[model samples]
Target chain A: MTAYKGYLIDLDGTVYRGKEIIPEAVEFVSSLKEQNLPYLFVTNNSSETPESVAQKLQNMGIPCETKHVFTSSMATASYLTEQREKQSAYVIGEDGIQKALEQAGITYEEDQPGFVVMGIDRSITYEKLAKAALAVRNGARFIATNKDVSLPSERGLLPGNGSFVSVISLSTGVEPTVIGKPESIIVEQALERINLSKEEVLMVGDNYDTDILAGINGGIDTLMVHTGVTTAEQLKEKQEQPTHVVSSLKEWKI
Target chain B: MTAYKGYLIDLDGTVYRGKEIIPEAVEFVSSLKEQNLPYLFVTNNSSETPESVAQKLQNMGIPCETKHVFTSSMATASYLTEQREKQSAYVIGEDGIQKALEQAGITYEEDQPGFVVMGIDRSITYEKLAKAALAVRNGARFIATNKDVSLPSERGLLPGNGSFVSVISLSTGVEPTVIGKPESIIVEQALERINLSKEEVLMVGDNYDTDILAGINGGIDTLMVHTGVTTAEQLKEKQEQPTHVVSSLKEWKI
Candidate 1:
């Protein structure tokens, strides 16, 4: 009775952007809804959570559910839990970070920490940096959320978590193994969560740097949608290519 | 009197790696100590705390103090605080995240976050994703710590923070504005902390991704020590080149 067993879709230009919804995106989702197809919102952005993303789509009349959304944050968290024994941690981020840690039942340090995890701390400070550096120097474990130097925006591209991760890595001389988009960790997480083999799922997105790379790295079929950031001309120039390409979600059979 | 008014140094290949220090690195520091030198350990790795890195180096027989460290985490976090009018947030990371927020005097939350920061949350969860997604959709600000997609390891290359940041970005339909290494924010933070002009400090590191980039972007002098991940051939092929390239930190003048 499942119209489609697994569907991993894109965000950004695919669903919404700057405060505008692209045409036909809603209709495309409506078709999936009419078919009772289960779809997942797979994205490359680690700055926000699925609930907020889904809510945005719905606000723009896309009719999305938070349950149907999965992010790199979820993927990376899943990957780390699988790779190591879960331990208490000191987080440097927001709800997305906390949710990930709590779901793993990893206790966090508000007072004293045994492990220091770095991400994009919008609220940064010298004391925080000193503490994190000290914790690592003193033998607390360290992990970074990701390593993106910049994220593109309507105004312009700007720095991201990689900059912060580098600071700690530079300061502590200890590199954090990151877990997020374009890495096998999130894909593996997605596969495990969907309860499907890699081949059964399709990765669709606009950006080649993260989404398509994620699919290729994760061992899934990738469908490049021209709806997001990358242009078709750009794809043709790439040394690598996706498994498939589409104009939008409307072009997919699922 | 300070033998050196300011110091900018490199990590990885310059300092200690896997229980061994590069030859003469210790002696070089000893010489600095023999004549009171004020120095700073600057690195491109964004995932760790400087205290931890300083300890790692000290363990390798190179003595360093926490005061002599600057990280991308602090830089980006500082930028975030400066841009925000209010200081409430939803975190998505580890010790670095909490520390940065507290030091910034930013109020943090699980819900109703004015700003949601995504970092390297190795322990991500569905609930966290949902919370962030919901908040961003509801108009909470989105920010990230860095943008490094891969990390260097004692073993090999691995997926890093950049990819994860992208994933959350995909989900939220909001791209993060970042502040870290290889960008002006962290560089400015470092300048402010040192209370010196860019001309007075020399950025040193092994990685071209961060250290060199930071100096170049910040308009500071950069020294690339041939000890870490990038090779001479790699440096030659860089889109941007460092001001000085040395065989080792020992051969370089302070």
Candidate 2:
């Protein structure tokens, strides 16, 4: 077996389920930290800043720092930076994406923007969407942080970023460039941040559709854990198998 | 030529364009009024009440009353009335839909709704959409007033009711039953309202996609005028042509 040198881990399902941290995941992460292995918590959540995400993990007794968190918002900002276009955007998101763009020196413009970036926003309104639709129609480049349709909440599945993204895309008849999991863009961005080759790193997550498919699309090894969304029975239905499968993070060797 | 006993007319393009009323349309409608021919102004706009729409037309000096206007909201309410399920809905819309649902005696619900009716709303919010998505995922029957992706405004093409409807439907992986133009439901409802059979009336409009298609879908004759969304060149590209075609309403015989 090829031992992985670094790890790119998913947040919500793999490290913690909602507000509760998984005991085995904590132990595994601690073991990685003890060995001084480089690992980054790569999340599709564009609503929280890296500092907040790191703080949440620390509160759960997990070893994490702001630098160890690679979010889709950061990936999206990085993606925009490489475009070589004007660094102005009409944005729809929360603290994370807003801060990411600000950090990247991207100016916020409502009209005649170079790009229109959409992320998860709980306070979304019609006027915001109308502006986005009009901008996109006027030929502004469209982008979405992630395309997770349904957000799992205690209140059942709510509208996710992708659902909101659809409003503009459907209205303007333009598809957005998605910068999160299930696409290789975020994975490549994570690889650059971790400073590791694809062959030496392993992507670990509980969700098959986003995390595992992302690893496959990015040409990296993936370890599917059963502690979250996809069950062992459900994983069997997929054609492309993950490189490794474990009942829990404890089942994997360091 | 068959002397049509009634007429189902479309607003916006057929009768008026934005704030300006079409002169040819006014003359044609006056001829219908002078001959005492029953006519109903059918529209996909679910934002304004029939009274408001009629007032807009009456203000334009085109003989119109509340009784002569049939909106998508009214059709949606009529649809719900024919359903065997309980008459309660979690709605996402403006005055037209709200009034129609209330007039139909359908109660407003949030927690456990029997149906989820979506329409055009300029004041749309994430909270309202979240509730609609949650309700739909909880097995509520989903319905949309119209499937017009973009709404024409003085500013530009903005996100329409169908675009907003995409949010809930995309999140829940559910398709909505559309009740407006191009679906035939509104046409059937208008026929019922005007007390006319399909063979006894002609559906007149300036847009081939919505008006003409609705007539064709509802098994009625259609007259496509060249004053709106679809141009004469565009109409020639369609596989299914309208029953009658004219450059202006003045070219048609009452």
Residue-wise lDDT of candidate 1 within A1-254, one digit each (tens)?
12345767776777766688876677777877888766788754555677787887788898688877777666656655655544677777766766866787678774456567766655655346555656666667777666665555453444466655655665556877666667767777777777788867877778888788888888888888888778988999988798788887677776
TM-score of chain A of each: 0.86, 0.99
Best-matching candidate per lDDT? 2
DockQ of each: 0.04, 0.88
Candidate 1 TM-score, C-alpha based: 0.51
lDDT of 2 at A252: 93
**Candidate 1 structure quality by residue, lDDT tens digits, B44-108:** 45456767867777777787877767665666567667874456888777666567666777788
Return the clash pairs for model 2, or none: none
By summed lDDT, which 10 consecutive residues of candidate 1 chain B come out lowest? B150-159
RMSD of each: 12.5, 1.1
Candidate 1 off by > 4 Å? A1-4, A110-115, A138-141, A153-155, B1-254
Q: TM-scores for chain B, in order?
A: 0.86, 0.99
> Ten-residue segment with the worst summed lDDT in candidate 1 chain A?
A150-159
